[model samples]
Target: MVGIWGFIPHHRVLEEDTILQQQQEFEHSIHKSGSESDVVESIDENTEKNDKEILISKRISSDNEKEHENENNLEVEIQDFDVDYDYVPYKFGEKTYKIREIRDEANRPWWKVFDEFEYRNTKSEAKSYKWYKWFPEGTSSAEKKLLVKLDIFLAFYSFVGYWVKYVDSANLNNAYVSGMKENLGMKGNDLINTQTVFTVGQIVFEIPWIFLLPRIPITYGLTIAELFWAAFTIGTYRVKTVSALQAIRFFVGASEAAYFPCIHFLLGSWYLPHEVGRRGALFYIGQFLGVLTSGLLQSATFKNLSGNGGLEGWRWMFIVDGGISFGVALLAFICIPGTPAKCYSLFLTDDEIRLARRRMKKNGTDVNQSTKALFDLPTWKKAFSTWHVYFLGFINILGFNSNNTSSGSFVLWLKSLKKYDTVMINNLSTVPPALGILYVLIICVGADITRKRFLFVSLSFLLNFIGNTILAVWDVSYGAKWFAFCFGYWSWSQSSVFNPLISDFFRKDTDVRAVAWMAIYIIGLQSSAWIGRLIWPTTASPRFHVGFSTCAAFSIGFAVFIGIAYFFYKNDERRESLENGIYLYNSETGDIPQFVLDHPEFVEKNRYD
Candidate 1:
């Protein structure tokens, strides 16, 4: 039912008859006015010259007249507005952002940030390129200020939320290595089993929540999820047995499940194409930062507070981490703008809200506020039947496995060497993630600036292949082992690219987006859960030949997936360039389109070709 991949559907397409009819009517009007001297450019030449900026309906109603009077007067201004491209109207959706005026913003600097931002997955382009690779580009002064506000308000909060999440999630491994294993008398595969239990809880809730996100205000859901995760995380501080640990982790995992798809759906709903990739990387960086923070906190807790609090240092890690989540939950409740259309963040005036929605609309993603749901069974059918869901979902399965979910292996490997103390081990585990942050900063921004997503995506996969290839040949030198672990983190940077890429592919519809992300987790997480328990059992230690080989093969699979995906991406791009203007994907059809309705004289089925 979807249009050709990468084909945006909003651009104007005028058939010759339609053009001739309009031209003839214009000529008659001119004759009646007796202005026979007026110059008339050929419609074909005019259309061909402004083809990229395909004309759109400019009809304005009474209510919108004041708002659009200036917008309608806009002309081609290449420096600020850049090149015009085809626009496709989003056919279905929920949520619309509103804006009241912010008179003070006329003078605000583009680089400075004030207080708030929230929303996700929509595309925004950066027409201007900056020499500085670390920063995002803005097409004009207004957009520059807007990007700054969004970075601070919506994007920053989402980043921190995911960052804090990793703190709680990554702790199980950190806790075990420090002292939990010996203290609790843990047995075989217990480490993997506890994680599996958490994964099980996550998969259990991920489905229903996909339906639930559409029905609920975003902040309300995220606040509850944060609180639930916090409470369960704190509960972990008191657990005494392995069974108790497993039980608490399941609740923690279930509550935490809401964050991923909901945040991503919002992300797609709000951002422009040029902006999402780096912002996604920022959201991802917060995660590694959290992991780094947790390891650092674990090291500090073990050394400074191990015996002072009458609780094990490992236990204290849970309590402090949980306390942080409580603070984040409060922030979410108070400030996280759910969607640009429904946002009421204390930081933004009504003006900024309208601005956010406008950005979305310009990018062809503005949707009517009542269009999606957790159980839109028809939309789900449309979503599942699309080629994107399966292709990207399979790639994510490889990514989920290759992403340093297999990370603590380095920690265990360091442990097996008995070369470092517990504190050093925690510290060492952070190095790869630290390096990962730098990798994403460089690679993602470069990809965003160059607008070559598949190019960088392919490069990351190549790095993943190289890293795992070295590790799989386990009979290597110590230097090789060290290099393999560090190199994998670079590939880990690919997760950021994957996030925006999926958002771009599924950006057209909320219902479809929710279903797509859900399917990915349902498949990806299951693969991760069983794969970790099987190939990466705790018994394998630093020399997990099976684990390394499995990871190596998955990296190769990820590379191959992107190669095939890029072809579709380009093919779709080619389709969008056609003058007939491809049909906006009719999701209701629920299969590869039975026909290309826009092509003249090339009808399908009983129609003449």
Candidate 2:
């Protein structure tokens, strides 16, 4: 028989003499007959004696076998460790297996196995951390330096790209309410039509982006997308008709669609599981900051630059914002690192690149790729069939809906007040986005610390429920409504953590991860745009009771979906443990399971420490 660890199973065969002795004892007992009770007693005593003797002999034999096996294993282990080779022998059950060419030892939680290899020459001391526990563990000095460099070069550009994408998309709304509606003779529903068509464009291009992203380098893809969107944003400055503005918006949306998911996918490729959430949060925060900055920029332009240089304030907003985006696109082309394995950034050294690749490999991430795999039908089928994609997509729809209540309608509410001018309306709109930035940072940091992403996601939904309830049911005062609007933005924090959640769940499969990540936004944004058009119709005005009520209900549903996802995830983990003959525990103090010690890819997913 083959053992579980893929080695020949050891078997002990009984000697012929031992078998004959047992048969003779049984025959003797059967033949002994005296008085009935006496015979029975005699047979019982002989039977007991035979059984005891057999047990004693078996115990002795087992001890001898174990002792011999241990001696052999020890010798093998010593020999394997003494050699400077890629493969190491590991003993499990009655078998020994060879582990080959480990790329990274430090990132694996079971690194102690390698450390204990007696003849290993490398420095294998446990890394010490001076920072908080939330920070990524087992990071070497080289990795720390690399992380700083990646943050400065890669993360910064991702943030900027995301920021500009949002600024360009959001400028339309700011422009519409400020003066674009009047300038282009856009009546009721024209503004909403623009949003709907933009979302349509986004949906149309989502799958194409997903297909192409893996084949092309992310930096080049993102830079090209950014430049295209910037040109469209600049084109918005020349729109003299509603049809022209709609055309410009649609193309802009299509170009900007790649930025979010692509950036997220890039981050997942570069960072460890523990390191991704905070960076993702920072990347997401850029969107809110962009929204906030957009309002401020519009206010400034309206106050100072309106009708100056032969352009209206709204037109000037696009021209200036597009110019800024063009500049960022240029910078991104120069600065953005494609991936840690194939990084072209001036900031990273060859050693750092190797270290980064090693870390990702240990995490079981696919660091290498081929263009042919991009169109693999089986890959897409598996990715689409998983519950992770559909459930997360549904949850994201709710999240998008909840956030839109703040971003879409809150400024409109300010406009409806009539007491505030365009400047005040633009300036006041910044409040929710600013608060959203802080909320996102706090939640994301907490998620990283606790490693409870779904928990935070639930809390965000609950906050949305509360915020929406106030907006839907309460009409006591403007102060209460404004507070509700600001509170509603807190749900935007969910976006920050969602990427990390997806990254962790799909960490083992690159194609699935890429497809699922993009699909979530595609489904969520399209659903929100369509559903939002119905609930927040032109008739609803400032107090869209129907929209708020629907959002509050979805918030509850979102929480329920999160709970369901958690249940399934736990069940899946347990099933994996059972199939592998490994016991699952909530702590990390017991014997390291052979499965984990052998498979570096499962270390992070299985580690409870």
Candidate 3:
């Protein structure tokens, strides 16, 4: 039991500061650092086609005086972090951004001699915050070129991949309400049971991928996962009983379990902290559209294709959804840009690859983790030892449960009325997720513009709690209930903010980041499996008193826990700054290398900082 619970320590939790001094300090610093933090963008997408539109990288000069004298390389003048010339802001006309250059030659095997990253400096942000400038401020031409390719290949892939998967998931809900329950003779709690089985399968299968990813090639891992999801999704069309539906759902869930967190890690591996926000937002857009598309698809199919091939509309939905999933899987084979260090994309150049690595290093992102460390007992120990794992994992559970409305509660309510056709019901069910797009945009855009991540996140949860509270009242007016349903959907999507926030928080340890990402869905989903079966059985849907009450409590938990986590994160950053004069990014992760996955180096690895 001690071994099992070792990750949780008494010191991990923070007392709500009566004075809230830590909160004050963090908010103050974020304005300065976060403005320039994860928000940088790629240079002009069109102008850099020939790569001539770049700020040329000069060769490292043997004489510091001569390098500074060069006219093309503007002499940088900044007030922070630059001691011994290592942390210097670079000049671009009248505007300059904090740029740090670090050189460690002992183990530097790459072509670039020094790693130069653009530091998130608020000093320049005051002047640089333009309402209209599209590119990241003070970006190098080479860096811009890389961001364009990454946006094209990886960002779009992130959007499309989640879009197809969610479309299928929402299809499951639509099918269940449309005709599958009647066809399969699904009785009390059967809908919840099917969902529970999928959660169980996901939890069971997620463990291996969490451990195996860094130890295997990216292609092999993606192929296995996609094959499973595609086959099981297609198989669902043939299920004759609830048991068969549950069985297929389980395998489909298990196969695709690693996707959400893995993509998050992939994004964090390649992009800066500021870039992550909008990219993460784009990723969630796919999900919203997926849910929305599922409804529209069901409506059209029921009207057009039902009974055409001795198949119900729900069955047809599965066949079409599965085909889409398979097609997206093929796209993944080509477009999945492996980690920045080991990127094997056909769109990137050698210089752009190096630029990607430096950008990550600027914000202390670890882009060079060794696969050889996978087996080290200390590596596993470092991953588990941090408060980050427990704090972040549990916070995600609370966040997800807070948002989970079982059996598509809105759909269930519409179904209960017995007044709407399949077409109207499907269309009505989409309102919450559709409005959610705007809600998410408001929150994410606020966080990006103000550089206050925790502020928006806490506000998101507070509103989530309010929405669930209204639903629990259940005796309210009809229009009010509709308002509650729509209100909840608008506030419920915080995973986008949380994804990059968690990535930025746990940036140092790659294993811990991966594990925390895994915990978000793995452990969170496991708890959900039990909750769905017992507390939220469809028999009680549309007015699940216990479930709604539970959601309300967890929503508050989400707020409290996130606040506590933020306090500690800032506290750590504060202490490190005080001790070292400035926070030093000890991050070391690399792009995916060929041999790291197949035959890891057995070199003795350093313990996690």
Candidate 4:
């Protein structure tokens, strides 16, 4: 019992200020050692020459220079147990101390080189202590195995969900011309409005749900949302009026609002930075898989299910899709992890949880405190202060344009062409979107390995812009139009970077992190939904050239905007690192990486800072 209750000596909850002060002193020391630190900035002759300094805090110290630098280094080596002598506390509690690193001329603290456990112990200890040893809850072997399985499962589930959403949206177009008009008496843009309404639903509830998701069981909220969409999806089959269809679609949209944000939060909870992108791509794969599945399924069943048991093929599509959603939702509830502490049920051990906490803490995101309040002020200020949020919004509009004009309506456009048989059209349709999934994986993996994302995202948007341009100007070959369709799928690849970027923007503020993420989704999602309607009107059916052109322009415009924002934002990551007191070293150059995720203590620090 003593082992369970008292595992270690009194532990200090390392607050953000302590972290920030340590980082500041570290940076100051780096600045002071002009020559020694210069070694860190050494040129890599093989790589292209760019003036970007990746990290402000991390630097390479040559082994030869180590002895001399170590001697000359004015910073004291604060032992893990020596913080009481080095730092003066601003506040005092039995389990806490407002600690500061001893500063020198360069403001480098003696504690910079200390390991996190040592650093933490030097400053404060918990109110109680235990002489007994306590074994962690899970074994090392179990933790490793659990993480791999969870990673794969998360990737697969997310991918499937994305596929379902996109495939379902696209199928509406296929149904519209496959006798949906005659069966339902639907006319004009009412078809477009359904898609528009869905986007609005996504926009309206995304932020609130994201804010609320982490507070409760994630599986519970996600399952409820899925159920709503599933019910609406089935309800769509019964709609005989625009009002009826609109109402059902609106509810469906609301149901889906939580899916993206919720999944993102889920992914973040389980994976580290390098792991997030590829895992995210798994979700995008769902879009690709959904597209493939829809085409194949539609080709096989459209004719047979056309009049099966008093339901048209189109009606069957909704019923089947909705049913699948409901089933998947049920499965997800049983599988998804609620939080890191409890993930041991998924086979993780107590040590892995400790390591996970330490890893995230070292990565600069503190998950120790209540995540509910992370979005309060400093985080929102960080989120809203930058142009990245607005750029993300515009990019979302670009994504909406691509999804609406090409993805949602591609089948109808092909039907209007009268160029190929159902199988041929279905097969041809798969190419463009399949390329999109490919591009998303390639870009995400590249970003993960290289530790650079914004540049690749910009380049992808440019490629999409070029693809849309060809579709807009050249109409002679069906091949050129086909190329445009493929390019449109890549548009969502740009969306992949947005979430990761949001993670960076608020890496310091835990209180408002969830809400900040929700704000990001709301702005990008809602604005773009309306934009999709404005660009692709119902009247422009058969050929959505104008809409495609508008999409191209937004895609290009957003790319350009992101580029400019990148320039202006110009790697304040070191500043944030110092402000947060964590080192996320760039693996390639051995410098601190330019991107930072929020620490969990941003809210509490804000009031005092």
Q: What's the number of clashes in each of the models?
A: 34, 0, 18, 26
lDDT of 1: 0.67
Which scores greater on TM-score, model 1 or model 4?
Answer: 1
Error of 1 at 97 (Å): 25
Question: Tens digit of lDDT per residue, candidate 3, span 522-563?
Answer: 667677777656667788877887777777788889889888
Best by TM-score: 3
Per-model TM values vs. the true structure: 0.75, 0.75, 0.75, 0.70
Model 1 lDDT, residue 480, Cα: 88
lDDT of 1 by residue, 314-346 (tens): 999999999999999987776566665455455
Candidate 2 clashing pairs? Answer: none
List per-prediction Cα lDDT, in the order shown. Answer: 0.67, 0.69, 0.66, 0.59
Off by over 4 Å in 2: 1-138, 371-373, 405-407, 577-609
| Candidate 4 TM-score versus the reference | 0.70
Worst 10-residue lDDT window for candidate 3 reads 9-18
Q: Candidate 2 at residue 475, lDDT?
A: 76
Evaluate model 2: give its TM-score. Answer: 0.75
After superposition on all C-alphas, the RMSD of every candidate to the true structure, in Å, is 15.7, 18.6, 17.7, 16.7
For residues 323-424, could you state the per-residue lDDT of candidate 2 as single tens digits? 999999888876776765345455555445545665676555666443334576766787888788788888888777865543368878878778989988
